[model samples]
Target: MADRGAGTMSLPDDWPDHANAILALNRMGSFDWDLDAGLMVMDAQAHAIFDILPEEYDDRPETLAVRVPPNEARRLDATVSQALKDGSENYGAYFRIRRRDGTQQWTHTQGYIRRDETGRPRRIIGVVRDATQELADIATRRERLEQDTALREQTNVVQLTTAALAHARTVQDVIDVLKDTHGLTHLGATSLVMGLVEAGRVRLIAEGPAGSFVAGTDVTGIDEPYPMNEVVRTLSPRFIESPEEFAAGYPILWPHITDLRITSAAYLPLIVQARPIGAMGLLYNDRRGFTAEERNILVALGSSIAQSLQRAMFYEQEKDIAQGLQQAMLPRTIPSVRGADVAVRYRAAAIGGSQGRDIGGDWYDLIPLPGGRVGAVIGDVQGHDTHAAAVMGQLRIVLRAYAAEGHTPATVMARASVFLHELDTDRFATCLYAEADLATGVVQVVRAGHIDPLLRHADRSCRRIPVPGGLPLGLSAEFGSLEYPVSTVELDPGHTLLLCTDGLVEMPGSDLDDGMRTLTALIASGPEDVRRLADMLIDLAEERGGDDDVALLLLHRRGLDAPVGGGRLQQHVAPGDPEALHEARHMVRAAVHTWGARDRADEIELIADELITNALMHTEGAAIVTLRALAGGRRLRVEVEDSSSALPRRREAGESGVSGRGLLLVDLLTDDWGVEARGGGKCVWCEFDVPESDRRRPNRRR
Candidate 1:
């Protein structure tokens, strides 16, 4: 190379014709600068770089330096100084320079600096190339590099965030992952918008940054619309590069956003299953614009988040339906039993999850037994889910079956336990079985690893029955072999028995004894009825030990000699012929027998026939018959009823009518007789007293 280190002389020094002929070049430029003097010199081609005439730079470098753009002058000086300090023989920098016509063009100057022997810089010489084409080429390369870098960064962020969003089940879970993974704080200021097309509304389901925004506040009614509205309506992604842009579009959110210092934002429409349900917006505090790549990544995350929300809502609805169905299958109210008052209460769990709606294993039953007896049972299986509830239902049916077979309390429990053990079940259960016979005023109890029942006596005192306890059912192979002895107590009149599950007494900070004391206090207060008392007791337990499910059954014994009576019967019949009279007599006899007047059955039958025969022969069309049975000191009074609209005409004993003989027979047989009109019907009565000997006979049919 000829003089490769030449300062501003890298091109041939020949005439313009020679340089043009060598390379068929159309244009060229060269220049020199005097740094200390702040002067510059240029050739004809160099002057053309600034679009200036060649005479403009003759004998003066100041003209060219002065022609340089003011804003780029400092940059040009710095480049010149840097090149001289590095002692580079050749160097180039691209900058903007002003032309004499007040227009601008890009230039690339390449040159070197001349120095004295002491290494001090003297003058700067450079070749000024009109590099508008070169500048365009470099800018194209830079643009490509920037685009690639931005795309790479977006791909990385989307891949990482998508993985996190994939695992988010709840709205809170999404917020947590975003905060932790994306270095985001102030989560509460953020809102998740979900579209509700059916309601023609958009809902804010979840918000983060705990104290900033209320969890359930609805922004639907805000005065000015949100940019997210566009996202949803258009089903596209949108972004606000600055707070000014957002405020200009949404004036109402401006104040709220300014107070939060939100400067930039991205609104992404959430589309799932090829449908757009809503949009999500990410707000930032600085005016940071999201790249196209970033917007696309956010869209992917929004889609996944939308799908998760849909699934969660579906799960919640399913849980509610299952819970309702389960409760409907349970008893609404306990059955009524004579000689005893009964009550029951049931409760389910309050947890949320897959097993949330499955019933627990706690259960209670009050079955009426023969001879005015009531069978009571309270049991709990070994789990808190649907399987346990199924086992409990099976045990209940089996217990009732055994009781119906007339097994003793201990026998019923023994057989039930054995059946449960033999069943192909993986869970065990505890139970307490008891029977109360109101006639005998006795209670028989059997316990199998269950909580003991509490008895509140008529005296306002309490006692807990201690029966022989056995292992929980289903745990032993020889379940019935373990004889659980029967325990009995005299259930006196006005006394109450309470059977309950462990959930009643097993409170969080208190034990079984404390629960028993609380229950005892409740029962001792003497509630009016068994049902009322049962409710009070359950409420008390819930106040103290509501962590678990509760089940309780209460029974109150009535006095053995309590008086019982029958209601009136108003009957309408056609005027009786002989057949009608016989039917009326049969009805009176059956009524007296059902009212426990069996000893007077024959006498009442004959008296009713004579009275009814007289009424049928006297009245026309339909006749009403009435029967009344009054218990009077070992005797029953019988009444024959009919509607005559007129009183019967009685005759003296000497009167010789064909029906006159009927009254004489009634007077001879019965101790008393009378006639009275009851409403629209008249009652003719006769009484028969039981003999002293007959009264002592046992009433075997109860």
Candidate 2:
């Protein structure tokens, strides 16, 4: 054992035991320093810390300091000095030292300083231990903290993006959100390209970043289809990781895509009802790879977008078909009455907005009566869409039949009301039926829960015709009691009768009185003809209350002598028995020759004979035929009237039906042939092309 300074206590001979015990228990070593003698002492465990033998120590503090690494020596000296200067009893610091074997070790040194009575440092004693494990542990904790922070930030971004996508209203909106977010993070552009399958075309409805691809360039002529086309065709999704692969697989899009600098893309099919309507292509500007989570999010968003687009398309198609069917159900042309000029006008709703299928229960008709009288009707069913149109058609036919059978306006409406109530057609309807006797200028009207018709006399004053009775048709068993009163008014020359549907009176932002006022003002404007009046009334309604579908019919009674036979007639012919055909041919030839139509007499005679004879044989009744030469050289019309009211249906040639062959013949021979209803019967009519040369001939009455 070495002798130490006065303040240092000499270690016992058994010090090794304590030293060894400390080393085994805590992997630590012990050391001491003598300030006065400048001597240092270390246990065998301390020697082991530096990989040096305990016998190598010279028992001198200066010698030990010389053995310490230069950097560690300075650090230890500074700590010891600080403790002594502060007159502290203990001090500690961590330092790095090199072992004899040239390995570095981190260590902590703690010391106790002995002070004189005045609290000045005299000597110092301490122990040093290896701390490499603690340092390593701290480093690991710092790395873990950094990793966790990054993961949390990514999760927050994903959650925000998902919420944004979920709330998007349209596919375009969803694509926009995705494109914007993706561009913010990835510094790339995005685009949504759609392929319309039915049209065999592609369109880009929404494009992000550049937004220049929104109109879509045609890639249909490409040799191979794009992945989006395949996805739609196969009902699957595809991801293209490389531009080269895309160009190889879809050569047509290669030129366009190469210019776009799209390095990565995804193609998703937009499917509805198990059928593909189109494909959505998501393009990225740089080569990119999607993780499983990101791909899942995109797929879900694609499906949602597809469903929304499909819903919008279905709504549009349904509206279009309904509107088309409704228009087809309406009468194409008003029947020309001998003693009255008639006109009608119908307008459809604008496209794409919520005003779907402008078809409603509104309807109108003009029926020619005995003694140059004309019957005009305007009515509304209780609903809209196809059901209403069907109901209106039924009412129209029934009322026309009743009027042609000579029923008075009141009696006609009474019977119609009862028929409607008892009829199995599960619909309720309203109507205003009126009959104008042109010879006496007496107008008779009946209203069945319908708006009263307006009358504008030659004095330019307007009034609602008084027909105050009846409930809407199909409402009750006692509908006959609700029969409208027959109101009669003597017509003055040049007076006009205007019949309209509720769509006219029930315009938006206006009450019944306001509508009446508007309509009366319109009538006072004094249009030139019934056609002009009908058009103006509908226009006025639209200006005031365009929320509904409008239907109007106007009638102006003309003097009995006003150009009675001014319009021309057209004739169509079919195959029939030779004898009847020949007799009809002779009549046609004689009529045409009498009218000095020598140039077309032969063609007209042949066409008329075939048409009349075919009507007589196949129409199942006595056929009444009439011929008229049209004005303005427009057409020559021939009408063969039959008692049978069953409409002539067109059929294929060689069919079992007896009428099939005749229609084929007519179609081959005539420019056009149509069947219309006459009073209590049907008329199969045809038109023939009259040459300009034949029209130039002078009229020579027979």
Candidate 3:
């Protein structure tokens, strides 16, 4: 026995029986462990505590392995080794040991290390006891029952949280889920703080409880004294059971959160695949300490959160990449056109679920062409992915090039279709291209498996222009339907022409025609400003979210600062095509009458017929006839173009000859005539002066 301090009792060195009696009475046993000799000496009472007889006892600790399970022995050895290496004065642990009857019993052990003068551990004095009865007592059973109930509640909360997190597709969405009123609060947390590990630093992504966030903590080092950092570093959970423990363990983080009145917290390492990706802290104000079961429950919850957060992060990254690619594929900016208010817009799709990316092939462009013409294009590729966007980019470039090459509307569309088919991609696109001559208010529109363009009248009423179309780009060329019909429409001053992908007019569960009619009504009631009208349509599409993208173009013809009533009309006349020549005559008559020159409609139609007839008879190609009301409706000019460089000369015609009489009639009409050399062709133009009374007449039809 060692000497005792004042007022304390001491036993003589020879009082072994007294110490044995005290240990036996308490159902505890004492042992002496020699570190240098690797041996242990246990008394009869200690053998009894281990449920072993005197004959079964061993002087060496290795011999005790027969009584202690291998797992229990290893755990005990490790605990002892850690305590000794850390210079711990004492250590205690609980383990399970199999008894002689093949039954498991809970056992506890405590050891006090004895160090020599040189500070090296020499021996250990310890006590072993059976803790089964202590653990099975009435109070402990009741406490464990409460802990079990709390575990069930916590598990339920975790399930609810996981369900909520399933819908989170972005990092911000994850934060919103965590900060939702009905969220994480069910986990018995008064406040929550979460951080993601980024580039060896923990970024504070979420902090709640309204103003509890400390400034300058948005990012922190992993080696900081904060409990979150501690768990992340160790890949283990930390239970701060009291404010005192929290303050002592995290001196730097305590002062900032003292005002929160937090009494306890649980910090968990958000680990996946045995590596920590981030960390989370659940703070408590009403609770004082956490039971072992509660700590385990929180750790499980943290694992679920880690998986969801990783998924959300990956989704956001993919979305960003998809959007960036789509934006790069689309036109960077629209070119301004003279004599028109042009507005263009594009919106990407809002796709959901594990698809992870939201992008599509919708695109719009404004291409300036030769001869005072501008091409407005709106198209959508067949899919919603990076591949579709790539195809769209190639198709848009080719379409622009064809339009800029002075091709007619139909030729441009056919060439684009051929280009797309030759690209060898298994994709197709619906497209509409409108070539408008702002000077003449004439729009030649060509459609390729796309919806009709909308024409808003000067009165703000809108209607669909039913343009005949061929198959979509790739399919048309594949099926040999390369001829796209062009429809001509007059875009009067103050009227607008609208072209958009079907995404703008499609409504789920509704017929496409019905959707178009609805769109027409919407446009009719929308504001008159082109830019504002474009915004309104796009905003509506955004509000009615769908799994498709949208592209739109609006071209509003500005009222010219010159004349108000005069107009121009053009028609292409092919050789030996009576219908085209007849259309050319009708166009001349209509333009003359619409310009209030009905009295001269007969003369104008006759002269236009003779010119078209001569061009068709003498040329190997088609004739283009153009009629214009000039000088504010006081004069009308007719021009006929042919792919021939030869100039026409007056010839004497006998009474019965019809071939040489065509140019003679033009000389007989009251008009000035001339010829101009065009590229590989010639244009013969004539002008007619109208009477003032007829010019001042109201617009009328014959």
lDDT of each: 0.66, 0.66, 0.83
Clashing pairs in 1: 40-61, 187-208, 187-209, 188-208, 188-209, 624-642, 625-641, 626-641
* Number of the top-ranking candidate, with TM-score as the measure: 3
TM-score for each predicted model, relative to the true structure: 0.46, 0.51, 0.65
Q: For model 2, how does the per-residue alpha-carbon lDDT over 1-702 read when each residue is reduced to its tens digit?
A: 245422234433534655557654787776767676667677666667656665666666556653478878888889888878876788999888777667778888787777778786666666777887887788788777865664455455555656665555444545565566542243232665665565555444544346344224544422236676678667888877788877887786577556677888878787777877767777787657665655665566566666667655665576677777666767767788755677887665432234345567677788876434578887777666777777777777888888886566876777777777777677777788878755446678778788888888777788877667578777733533654677887665677788887677765567987877777776878576777777777776656546467778887766544323333233333345455455556667766765556766655666666667656766655565666654334355677777667877666755456545666666776766777655467777776666777667776654
lDDT of 1: 0.66
Estimate, for each residue in 1-702, the C-alpha lDDT of model 3 and write its tens digit.
211111122223444657767877899887777778766777666776678776666467887777789999999999999999999998999888777898988888888888989889987877888888987795688987887787777788778778988888877777787777767787778888989888888899888778899887889898887788788899988888899998999898899999999999988898888878889888989989876777777777788888888888787787788889889988898887767789988888877555536888889999986434689999999998888989999999999887775567888888888899999689999999999877677889999999999999989999999999989998999999899988999888888999999899999999999999999999999999999999999999999998899999999988764233356678999988888878888888777888777888788888888888889888899999987775556677888988899999988787787667767788889578878665567788888888898877887785
lDDT of 1 by residue, 283-315 (tens): 777546876666666777677667765665554
- Model 3 misplaced regions, further than 4 Å: 1-144, 272-276, 354-356, 560-566, 569-702
Off by over 4 Å in 1: 1-185, 188-192, 195-318, 321-325, 351-358, 458-461, 476-482, 509-511, 514-547, 558-702
**Which 10 consecutive residues of model 1 have the lowest summed lDDT?**
1-10
Q: Show the colliding residue pairs in model 3.
A: none
The TM-score obtained by model 1 is 0.46
Q: Is candidate 2 or candidate 3 better by TM-score?
A: 3
Report how far residue 82 has shifted in candidate 1, in Å: 41
- The positional error of residue 387 in candidate 3, measured at the CA in angstroms, is 1.0
- Model 2 TM-score, all chains together: 0.51
